[model samples]
Target: MTPFQTLTGTAAPLLEKGKLMSNVDTDMIIPKQFLKTTTRTGLSKGLFHELKTRADGSENPDFVLNKPAYAKAGILIAGENFGCGSSREHAPWALLDQGITCVIAPSFADIFHNNCYKNGILPVRLPMDVCEQLAALAGGANHVFTVDLATQTLTTPDGVTHAFDVDPGRKSNLMAGLDEIGASLKVAGEISEFEHKRRLMTPWLEPAI
Candidate 1:
């Protein structure tokens, strides 16, 4: 996973009436038509493509992401069950490709949340009221927000702050830029020691080189 330090950028509101519509699934995030490629490149264009386009293929100017103020948004504040569809790593990849570094939501699907962490996207689970408040703040003109992973705090442009929680192991992995394999490699010395002991204890099972 790419290391995440602090992310400071404009945040967009993916909510309605101070709340986000629930069950914003992975299919809705990238849609089935855009899932052809395994590569992460060019996935940004597929992000919210269906929602941002009409049947006639014209842009939907009313879409939050299509709005001028949110075009370059890096943080997305949403509601419950933010990612509640198929278990696909591509979902987070698409969001990252669009420059969305963090997502603040009331809740998220288990698989989706794990995928987000693996892909270097911070998936914050705040209370519903807190998410609503953050969403409202995100609506301000060009409002900027900072997510400090080290401190586990989110600071808004108007000086308001919110504290959040992240699993210590996950936090460490993100901070150290280590994926699962990379994290395991951090204990390579211990692994070698274990192997040596195993070889000595079970010499009859050893294979000839």
Candidate 2:
């Protein structure tokens, strides 16, 4: 995980106007066929595979992601209840692999939200109306947006600002590029000291050398 301080890039609307595609599960984000790989490589090709393809595996130009302007979009302004299904870390992995560093939505699945932070993706949660406005703005010209995690704010290309909040511990971990294990290891000295004291107090619990 790399420390995520700020991301400034093109913001693309994940859906059209008034078409709120809620409850977008991990399976839909990346189908079961794509879950065979344990590695992050090659997952991007499967992103929204079902939605972005036709019955005969043809490219669906109608899909928002298939559009030329959004092809390389790094920030996704999405609807509510996004990522609402199974807890698959691969969802964020695929997004990150596809160069999406941030996701702005009204709501997200709990596990998916946590996975985003672990994988160096910033998941911004804003009010539904705010998200709708951002989505609308993203659809028009001026789609570029900036997300400053340090400031906990989202800045639209037109200078509009929206405040957001994240867990302080998560924020610290993200800034330092530390995952759960990395965070725990940050106090390794204390852990080692405690273990040493425990061994001295309970010598019989120690294995024979």
Candidate 3:
């Protein structure tokens, strides 16, 4: 996972009929069909698969992400309860693959929120009104937004800054680009030393083979 310090780029607003859409579940982000692969790469093609695809399997140009200006959007301004439903890690994988490094919403599913941090995606929770403000800004011509994890602030395109709270441990891990496995490896030396002492104290426990 890439270390998340600061990200400044266009923010795509996931809206419906000009209003922010709520309850965006994991299946909507990346359908079950795309969950077959354990690898993270190549899932971008399946990102928002249903919403971005027409009945005839053609591209839905109307989709927020399919639009020309938002095609490479690195930030997403969404509604409440984003990333709801199943606890698939592939949801974040697909988002990351699609170049979305930050997701701003009023709230998020607990499991999905944790997965975002683990996968280098910053999931920002703000008041619904605040999120709506950001979403409105994102829909305009100047839709760029900046998310600084170090500062724990999100700056809108018009220079308004909003603060957010994150767990210190999660913040630290993100800044260091340390996932669960990477964080465990950071204590490898201590683990090895403990194992050596344990074996010295109980030689009989060693395998005969």
Q: Which candidate number has the best lDDT?
A: 3
lDDT of 1 by residue, 1-209 (tens): 67898999989888655457688999989988888999997998888887788999999887789988888899998889999989978899999999998999989999999998888899998999888888778787647999999999999988988999999999999988887889999999999999999999999889888
The regions of model 3 sitting more than 4 angstroms off are 197-209
Model 1 segments more than 4 A misplaced:
16-18, 204-209
Error of 1 at 178 (Å): 1.3
Q: Could you give me the TM-score of model 2 versus the true structure?
A: 0.94
Cα lDDT tens digits for candidate 3, 130-197: 98888888888899888999999999989999999999999999999999899989999999999999
Looking at candidate 2, the ten consecutive residues that score lowest on lDDT are: 14-23
Candidate 1 clash total? 0
Clashing pairs in 1: none
Comparing 2 and 3 by TM-score, which wins?
2
For every model in order, what is the number of clashing pairs?
0, 0, 0
Residue 209 Cα positional deviation in candidate 1, in Å, after optimal superposition: 8.2
Q: Rank the candidates by TM-score, best first.
A: 2, 1, 3
What local lDDT does model 2 show for residue 129? 86
